[model samples]
Target: MSKDRLISLDVFRGLTILFMTIVNNPGSWSTVYPPLLHSEWHGCTPTDLVFPFFIFIMGVAISFAMPTKSYDNTTFNKIVTRSLRMICLGIFFNFFGKIQLFGLEGIPLVIGRLLITAIVGYALMGNFNAKLKTYLAVSIFIIYLILAYSGIKSYEIVRLPGVLQRIGIVYFIASLLYLKTNQRTQLLVAVGILFGYWALLTLVPAPGFEITNLEKGTNLAAWVDSVLLKGHMWEVTKTWDPEGILSTIPAIAEGIIGVLIGQLLNNAKLIRSQKATQMLIAGIILIVLGQIWNIIFPINKALWTSSYVLYTTGLATLTLSVLYYCIDIADYKKGTKLFLIWGVNPMIVFFLSEIIPQAMVMISFPNPKIATGQINLLDYLYVAGVQPFFSNPMNASLVFALLYVSIWSVMLAYFYKKKMYFKV
Candidate 1:
């Protein structure tokens, strides 16, 4: 396979992150479009597709990075270090939004810390002068230590298993499997994982429950999460985490499926058109099989059900195939730059996206128009700037999300122009 970067893959990744930013950062959760909202329990929404699509893309990336090769310490260390970094960053995300520093508390503290974090992160992660980067990183670290030690308390229970944490874990396992096993073995392992996870959830009952089931907060996955994670579970449903331990088994399968597809795309013998057609056919088959399995398993994103893995991966494959045909095969590259920017620097952008909103919500001011008499920065923007012009609240909310996305797009476009892609 050629070492040149895949424009189609980059565009696909960018599109996923772009939509993710929009759906995740809606101006008002109450006013979000139904399609943007996650299903309350068992089903898929456009929003639900975002996380799986990312994981699948990560798998494809792994295929590109880890060629069929012999084992070596450097390769092993690279995989371990990268996985650890992502996992640590995920945990840091949980802590950063909550940790109060130097009595500042709330929005100001979060925003300030994040700004420092960005500077230090850029210095360390970006291509910069080694000495200067080291000095800047150390100085920032010492300053953060002083502030953190002073008055950083009220650190609430943080959800341990999150989107990035799961991504990290899945990447580590999938990368290893890719390195050690052949393509057929990888495919078998992927299929086996889905079947095994299905059997584990359906046939085995939790300690307290009388029978195996897939009910919310009471299923085997939830029970395992409660047993292991305990207090460190999702705040929305303290009983379980969507990215829980048991559920990650199927998530790994999702990554492996991506790896397989990546291998197909990377096959030099097959022309681009043939690769696209094959992926399209494979996507359709998986979608059909997923629907058939949905009768029993029921495609559930929170549970990361086997059917959900199949369905979402199928959709992701189909999406990537179309992009491959249009961008790589046909060389039709109009409007691809927009997503390419966000795609190249997805991690940093996603991290900022999460924290910015947290800080905005924390920083509130008096608003007499609302019954609460107080409104956060984000709500204030929507209420005063975006809401007045529209009759439908949902439309206003969507516009705010779009504006947020556009701002980030502009910022990322500059970074892309400067060739400053942050890798984590």
Candidate 2:
């Protein structure tokens, strides 16, 4: 095995994933301030940036990590095995990662705070047949629309193709597309998907979709999802799903953007200064283009709008460029020990946050009322320790999450010292 070192790349990935944990597994979601909340319908927020940025970073990582030459059987086998593992893990999270397997006897906890789980399944799974995936995806929605129009059932804890599932489907094709086609074709395909999605949203009126306006309840995407997965829609958005069919068009761009970054990173001959400068310029260009696109597309995380992809991708790339210059070129390895830890095993911490919220939240001291029947360990600490003195729930929650990050950082540092990296 070739053990190549890319300090900046690992650090960038690590820092992004580490912040992902903090924003994802806070002490209390409701208690979080404005920056954490995803924009209600349109616009951006710190929370909104997390997922797309993660995806964008994945694109950057994929570009840097893909082999430069022809694949050998040994390398091919490893890639296949790892890809299969990622796909299965994504499925596990989808079906059972939500339910705390053991209610009381075992270490019971919320398996996942968020419903989106398609990140890995798509990225790794190869789309053997582009036609089949598109057919299946379309078929599922058509069947769902028929059922939904029939008013067969009310929405509840029903599951269907979602963000992760979409990723699996689109990613398979996108990966194949990346390998099978050239760069210009890839860019064209990306643009086509984006515009195609927009046109569909505007032209085809969903059931209950009016000629005047398609509100959240009546939006084409939500209507299609509800119709298809009648009994399987999420409890929260009975009328709409964030990871709906039409919405995924823009989502594919997220993965495609990754492929683009991967391509950029593939040029090994480019000097560090050249790479950094290119990224910074690209970031500036994207931010401006995103703003222009926002006039029509509306940069939305829920929809994963095209503008949103450009805006977030640009930021992610620029950030990576700066970090590369600082960490890899300038050689600042002091406090980076923390980020390097997360860079080692990000998914582990992500899973842990879901597996054990109490630990992530670091619930201590006296517990307080959080949700309907839940009182977090962290809440107790906040009320009994900080709330008595401070009044900001948001600040307290941020502090709590940061503290959790720090504790985990210590563990990560230990593993880093031992030179261990647990990958998916």
Candidate 3:
């Protein structure tokens, strides 16, 4: 099988990339869809589902794209080379994507840490005894305790858990799992992890773990986060470390779901009509399961609760099915050029936006408001230009979001025409 139908995967990926652009870059933070706002702590939101869905879908793509257990040395080398390139790109995106080198101390330390991390990761990424990997993971947790409570207050960058790091770690383990375990066992692990997190939060008492608020520094997750990672890192949530240790469990599930998705898509034996029906039914089941789980567990983006995973996975599947139906079955792909562009180079678009915000922000001019001389540029723009036109902040934010996507959409359109796919 070719393992790729550009329309379905790109459309689905494009959908995700579009939301990423929209959610990340609204005209004003104050305005957004109700679904867009992350549930404070114990609940779920549409916005919360976005990142996991994206990563999960990435996993799906990986399954389709990656070679199976059998491979020649040349092919293996190619896989290694590509994986290495991706790891580097992901790290670069982590370090320089959103940061500016201000002075001597930060730059040198950043370089020093990257060197150390590379050495450590290089040493770390070989065939270890299975139990040893488990032990190392456990030991890493213990060391995290020592660092957090050891009272050696130092802001070393690598000490923190970040989006790329979490992805790296989780994906590494996930690859091993895929190699070593059966589907049933992997599913059980995911279940255990989610419940384990729940038990920790509910049973293990922090000073005020029971109380859920936006103050990430004190929450149960934050306590673990503060203990495990101590630097600036927020990929999942703005207030909390988006890729917190507690949340990685569900994130892995996202990848596993992708495995299933890939299985469905890759099994070319199934007729297109059969695949569409199966996907639709599977998506519906997930949505139902997510809703039911929400009653007890609460679908939370920050938490990456199992229910949220199920719900988002379902929605993602359904969305993919629809795209497949339209583009392939119905043969109707009139205006998907823009999204296809962004879709092909989603990671590049993301990292470029993060790194090149200076040039990218020209799409919308900043309108600074003098609120007793304390002005916020982002909010001011929304108030002056967006708010006057749209009554609600959500509408204004949505408009800005559309424009933001449109800017990238246009760039992608040109990239699409030029056949420019900036792959990592």
Tens digits of per-residue lDDT for model 1, 1-424: 1347788898899999999989988878999999999998898999999999999999998877765655798778667656755665666566666665677866567677777667545654565554454454445445444543445344436667889889989999999998899899999999999999999999999879899999988899999999987767888999999999999999999999998999898898999899999999999999999999999999999999999999999999999999999999899999999998888889888677877777778788788686768888878888889989999999989999999999999999888888777775
Alpha-carbon runs more than 4 Å astray in model 2: 1-3, 69-84, 87-171, 212-214, 358-378
Against the reference, the lDDT scores of all candidates come to 0.84, 0.63, 0.63
Assess candidate 1 and give its TM-score to the true structure.
0.91
Question: Whole-model lDDT for model 1 versus the true structure?
Answer: 0.84
What are the per-residue Cα lDDT tens digits for candidate 2 across 1-424? 1256567767777877787778865656778877867788889987787777666665556545654634456544444444334444433443443333234222233323222233332332334354443443444345434543444333124355453455454555556566556778888887887777767766777765456233566767777777766655555776767766667677777767667766766667987778778878888888888889888778877666778878887787788778877877787787786776787676666555543553434223333353435444556655566555546778777887787788888888777778665554
Off by over 4 Å in 3: 1-3, 67-160, 179-185, 203-220, 232-240, 358-394
Encode model 3's per-residue lDDT on 166-226: one tens digit a residue. 5555555555565556667877876776667667655666554565433345657766665
| Pairs in clash, predicted candidate 1 | none
Runs in model 1 with CA error above 4 Å? Answer: 1-3, 68-70, 106-108, 119-153, 368-372
Determine the C-alpha RMSD for candidate 1 after optimal superposition of all C-alphas.
3.9
Write the number of the candidate with greater TM-score, choosing between 2 and 3: 2
Q: Model 3: clashing residue pairs?
A: 31-393, 44-299, 236-242, 237-242
Best by TM-score: 1
Ranking by TM-score: 1, 2, 3
